[model samples]
Target chain A: MNWTVRLTVNGEPHTLALDDPRVTLLDLLRERLHLSGTKKGCDRGQCGACTVLVDGRRINSCLTLALSLDGAAITTIEGLAQGDQLHPVQEAFIAHDALQCGFCTPGQIMSAVGLLNEGQAGDDPERVREGMSGNLCRCSAYVGIVEAVLDAQATLAGEKERAA
Target chain B: MNRFDYVKPATVAEAIAAAGAPGAAYLASGTNLLDLMKGNVVRPERLVDITQIKELTRIETLDNGDVRIGALVRNADLAYDASFARDFPAVAEALLSGASAQLRNAATVGGNLLQRTRCAYFYDTASACNKRAPGSGCDARDGENSQHAVLGWSDACIATNPSDFCVPLAAFDAVVEIEGSSSRREVALEALHLLPGSTPEREGVLNPGELIVAVRLPAAARGFARHARYLKVRERNSYAFAVVSAAAGLVIENGSIKQARLALGGVAAKPWRAHDAEALLAGQSAEPEVFEHAADAALREAKPSGDNAYKIPLARQLIVRALAAAAQGTPSRMPALPASPFSAVPGALHDA
Candidate 1:
């Protein structure tokens, strides 16, 4: 069944002609909208490689049907930066050496942003480890990833406080 | 993925009508259902989208203090609600402990209630999984049976119900409000999930078109939640299915256990509530020895497969640990390691 789904990707509005009702949100973003920053690792919920923020909540995009979210706002890894500048999470990832092959980095950053938004990004390493357990790095760069999330969380908090 | 037609139902009647199709399945959160669809485990020709039914998304409390949680309530919403957290902290903890934050955010209460087993053999399409295909034979019975059932398992299938919320709901004696098109009925939460006896394909007794509207937990659980705990032990510290989980609640008065409720997972086809064990706890003081007795009683009927015999002793100690923590009102406690009772069993040497 073909359906037209209107979605707000990043900041711009898009109306995708979904020919297949079985198309996943990840496929819709990557194939239809050409937002390939979101990689597909397991093609299932096991890996966090397809993580994206739908209405400010991190979800496995591969497991979400695109047609189900008709008017939802989706934030992908491509939407994280502003004019060649990286998001605080992306900057923290580069500073802390949180990636090796960089396949899971985008999902990791998106999940980290979502976790911080949910107030789960604590300064404690153990708490961060538990909060970021969903995003797995095959390169075993967890120590650096944990450090980066904590640093990005502090930076995000500072930016919020300064703005306020 | 196979092509499927989808319809967004606006009301409960429309949802029921849409779901009345032989090849129709209701899509609430699409967390597990979509995974299964992509895996080719379940192929539905049509999907009845019930998320548009706004009334099913509410969570409220009755005038009598019973909690009525809508089926469409997302796991994260119920897990993080301040009022629910303050009232039923154990239920909140149970919801939080099941899946990752990303999954919890997308998983609805109805999806969690009807979540499929995570058995390795059942997921592998090439393998013979009776749950997936009737009369296909269960390969997990003799192959890679480390996580298979140790209780309430028949030769047909040994897959356990992979639900953390169900453990506490069984202990709370929650009532499921089934909303049919023309009739409404109530089924106890414990009875909602059936044992996989002969038909592993049939997980629950809900009619095809009937929708689970809400789960109503009695007012007793509100008071009982103060002393309840849901302890889950898994292969990893997080993001793994339970190796053996126990939900326990005890009402102690004057240093003696007046009432007790116990439910176990990862060791049974359904959430195994130990009635005999709870009966033994009444009028007894909450002590390590008493907890051990209850644990022993719970595992007395356990029939473990050769490779997974370790689950027997492992589950017994978990029950003891969970009960001990509940009796003491401890928020967190480590499960005590006991010597494996099945160390002598053949092919179970890894547990020794």
Candidate 2:
């Protein structure tokens, strides 16, 4: 019993036939679609290493079944840059040295992008820290992660103003 | 995860019909169910995916001022809903205080209500948990049970419900709308979960195939919007289950407490609504003495099930602290940390 799921990944449409209903979004993206930029941490919802933007909202991909999301728009870590130009959050992470091992950087950047899109944190560092608490860096890079999120938030705001 | 059949139903009727199968379970966002499945704690032969049902995703306010929250509404969405937050501040705070932002964005209200306990024994397949395997004999009674239940637990099971959102819903007397195969009915949120008595396996009041369609807050629940608070004490500052938590709402008139609602979490098999405390505070002044008596009344029947006796006194103090914060009134905006004790106003704990 193969279930078909249609998803738009990184602005590309993909129609998949899943033979196993147990395949999670994390597995589908990494093993099937070969988008390994999304890391698999705890596999449980506790760790946010599998975080991605699903329809413009951040969610844990490990806990989400691929079959259930028939028409979701998924934005993974691979989707964050245009040519060589990194997204604002990606650039900010590098500018702030927000990664030591870089294992959790993709999840952190995707979550930070989602946070900036939500626009609830504003410029407050406390809010940014609280909002980004989901993505954990075992390197204890939280100081840099928080700074990067705040810096990226400002960059995105400025870009929006210039476009307007 | 074990292999399972999946069926996405487009309507509530179809979903209930699909779930009528013997080994079928309703699947919302799967934030909790998938985790349990991966741990081999729960394995259903069939999953009735109800995520695509558009009717179950709305948060509508009725003309009579009652707010109806669809069962599929995400935790983050419900917490950020402006009018929903304004009318039910404690519920919003509790929602925000729950799991990480990503989990909250994917976890639905129905999934949160039906989420399994965080009891270590229940998740361990090697352990003998009556809740997991009926009549297997409870191992939590003697094992590392410091985080077990302190109230409403029996020898059969000592697990506590670990939902921050449910604390405030139980306090507000929220109603759950259930759609059965043939009809629909309502159950009080307080009565939705059962205490782990002799039969610890029976967790909720829902029939096997009945689906929780929505949760409704009555018009009267809005009366406490001005003075409501949800306070949680966790091992960490955030992203952790409550060691002991409380939701307090007060309706004060001219410094006199006209009505009060209090409920305790992380201390019982179900959300422990403190009705006696609510009764004790009515017509009394919002003073420290009244709060102390109410807190004591709230924990009157709370006896520890294991080495977790510390939770009894901790829950009592949390009740008092939560009530005192409520009397001071809800903040104009939710604190950056939501319901964490660290988010409390400076010196509030000392004053309490």
Candidate 2, residues B185-292: lDDT per residue as tens digits?
Answer: 999999999998888999989989999999999999999999999999998767889999999999999999999999999999899999999999999999999999
Give the Å shift of residue B350 in candidate 2: 14
Where does candidate 1 stray beyond 4 Å? B330-352
lDDT at position B153, candidate 2? 90
B238-268: candidate 1 lDDT, tens digit per residue: 6777888988888898889989999987887
Q: Give per-residue CA lDDT, model 1, range A1-164, as digits (tens).
A: 57889899998999988777888999999988889999999988888999999999999999898888999999999999998999999999999999999999999999999999988445656557766878888998998999999999999889989999
Chain B, model 1, TM-score against the native?
A: 0.92
Task: Write one digit per residue (lDDT tens) for candidate 2, span A112-131.
Answer: 98999888889877777778
Model 1, retained fraction of real contacts?
Answer: 0.71
Per-candidate DockQ versus the true complex?
Answer: 0.54, 0.70
Cα-based lDDT for every prediction: 0.84, 0.91
Highest TM-score: which candidate? 2
Q: Is the docking of candidate 1 incorrect, acceptable, medium or high quality?
A: medium
